[model samples]
Target: MHTSDEIYHRVLWDPRFDPERFVMGIAERGAPPKRVALEDFVPGGEIPWHRVVFFEADGHVVWDRASGVDRVGEVVDGLVGPEPGDVLAVPAGHRTAVAWLPPDPLWAPIQHIRRAHDRQIRRWPPHVNVLFGFVPEGEFPRALPLVSAALAETPPFTARLAGVHWFAHREGTTVWLDPAAAGLEPWARLRESLELRFPLCGGRSHGFTPHLSLGRSPDPHPLVREAEALLAPMTARVTELVLLARRGDEPMRVRHRVHLGTGDVHHAAEPPPPGNPGPPPAV
Candidate 1:
């Protein structure tokens, strides 16, 4: 966890709970604890949760462990969720986005570089963002049908991650990998459609660059060169667009998956594990 100025900075881990499972960012000194959903922190895996052993010193082991839950639910029930009538601060990560999450093998190399250079490494997994901060989570129910209609005629296509590039900003230089711009016309058309539906969320901060972000640094040329050697051209089949949401600065988690062509919506009960590495393996 990043350093906090707050008086109480806590992380929770449990050796007995999924062995590799832990949860953090759940508590702050003065605020109501955020809702703790098993699907948010853990990735989907084979292990069943037998019990929860909570430790105070620290803190992802599965997504959708909901069905296999036993004593674990009992522990989470007491620890999770906001207290009644408590006011909570709106998190910067509150906004939502639509993106393509490439398979782990494809993005793992870029992620390896990001682990050292990217501050958002823990906040989000690797993805090629389509539309970001487009609407609020509450607006998704409405947004879903709009997205479905916009993409109804569009079919899934394959995207290639081909090269390294950068976006200059006053804060730093953001290095990214190109998702082959020539093939992104369909993505552009979909954006135009959604913009018609949600005008306020239409402006592109980086102006329509279809690249998967690596990370940012004040002087990034050296790291950019390093990434160039480690990175290889990769292709990912784009079958679905993932709708991601977060609660009050918590890490973003999958909310829904909108399939291409058919526009069939799937409520994500257990999102697949993120490409980002989790806790160190048990010794």
Candidate 2:
């Protein structure tokens, strides 16, 4: 039978990007040898299942013990390889195994992740629009969630399934700001509609709430009165709604919905402009 140490050595020495060159030995004594593409054994439909090795890129293994039984049998031939307890290096992305099996083991982890993703989609609320908002310095404590709740009635047009999100501002808040620009026009209209509908207090500041970010603020009541008093007379327009996502340590704007509101009406006391560029780089 092949020793676990031997298998480990082979993986360490031959790791490479060329999926075809890599080879896995069944055992020391059993079956005729065989070779195949590494991708065939991946478990998941798109992402696939592979063991991640120590190498930066070349470390990955894909094998399905159940469906690939015939393939594995061909690779091992009839050799009485390592017993169930003997360890073997499958591939880099594959999960750790106590030992190598004569035939590969069925890939189960991929199925689990798929099921979880489906469940998350099913549980999501249909009406919620997931958006992120940054709390301007003075705006943090009171404005975040309150604004989010106020706009709960607005429906998400893009990802109708994912609920709106108002992530805390900081370094991470930039992700949502970029896409916000797209909804500026529609947001401006919405703001105008709101101003026309609600009694505006004098001297209060007013701003358009992008459909996605309507519910992002924590509690904006304190500022609401002041903002309303300042903004009642002036019109509010939103040119875009920024959709941001974390990329590495910084936030990146991943998506944008422009011209959300009807016509344009610039608001007074609009917060300083935010920084960041187009939809966050694709994953």
Candidate 3:
């Protein structure tokens, strides 16, 4: 059964978002719709989560757990009455990511390669993606403590760019620099811990391979050699894990920084509103 947090997550990031024209409510068939405190709403305690939960947009029920069986605009009737509390506040229209951001001079050389072939140079910094397509941006606040707890035991370390490599995609070839095994071991362990709380944030089809992407290239062999010469000798002091986000097609910006060893999280003093362009990374 879906919890109110899950429903709120859908409302914020799902394609059907329409705060101006949408309403969240509960009702039994033939009963009038009513607003209830989401925090106190217990599924299976009073009203079953799936049977009575519903969302309305533009005057019609767009989603109702009791879909085919219930009437067009109402949920299947539930047994108990509603409770109290404010609607959970959530930001909208952004996707989140977790990464290890290499600082300063490291960014310069990476960008040099990126400037020539990487289309995403401006979209993201020189980063080793630990988790991409992470929890929705609106949920970062809720996810922070869990992320901190998962990473508490993983101490910071120097990460070396051991070599350059390439991956062949259907469209083209992409070049990236590999992190040394010492770095990979800790990163892998941290990823394993995070997976317990966020199973969906794991790497793509082939599983995780820690690398800092140089960019996409039509002929990656020449770029790989050049990147190897320029970047393979570099080492980064990885003391913190950064959480970043972006709206559609916009450049990503840092939302928070989770320090390693101590597991302390640094929150943004004033976060940009959903859909607005955010400040550039301070790295």
Top-scoring candidate (lDDT): 3
Q: What is the TM-score of each candidate against the true structure?
A: 0.62, 0.18, 0.63
- Candidate 1 lDDT trough over 10 residues, lowest sum: 1-10
How do the residues 130-246 of candidate 3 rate in per-residue lDDT, one tens digit apiece? 877687877787778767876787888888877888899998898988875455688887776565455445543457888888888888988988887776577777888888887
Model 3: how far residue 218 lies from native, Å: 2.2
Report, for every candidate in turn, its global Cα lDDT versus the true structure.
0.58, 0.25, 0.64
* Cα lDDT tens digits for candidate 1, 1-283: 1111110111112112332233423443477444343324442233222222222211221111223312222335234311121111112233678777887667568778888887787677787777776678876776787677656767888787787889889888999988764486877766655544443453544567677888888888987898889987777777888888866766667898888888898876445465446322122
Give the range of the ten consecutive residues with the poorest summed lDDT in model 2: 95-104
RMSD of 1: 18.3
Which residue pairs does candidate 1 place in steric collision?
A: 11-58, 12-58, 13-58, 42-62, 43-62, 43-63, 44-62, 44-63
Which candidate wins on TM-score? Answer: 3
Candidates arranged by lDDT, highest first: 3, 1, 2
**Clashes per candidate, residues 3 or more apart or on different chains:** 8, 85, 1
TM-score of 2: 0.18
lDDT of 2 by residue, 185-274 (tens): 433433332222121211114333332122223444432333233222212232233222222433232222222233121223221123
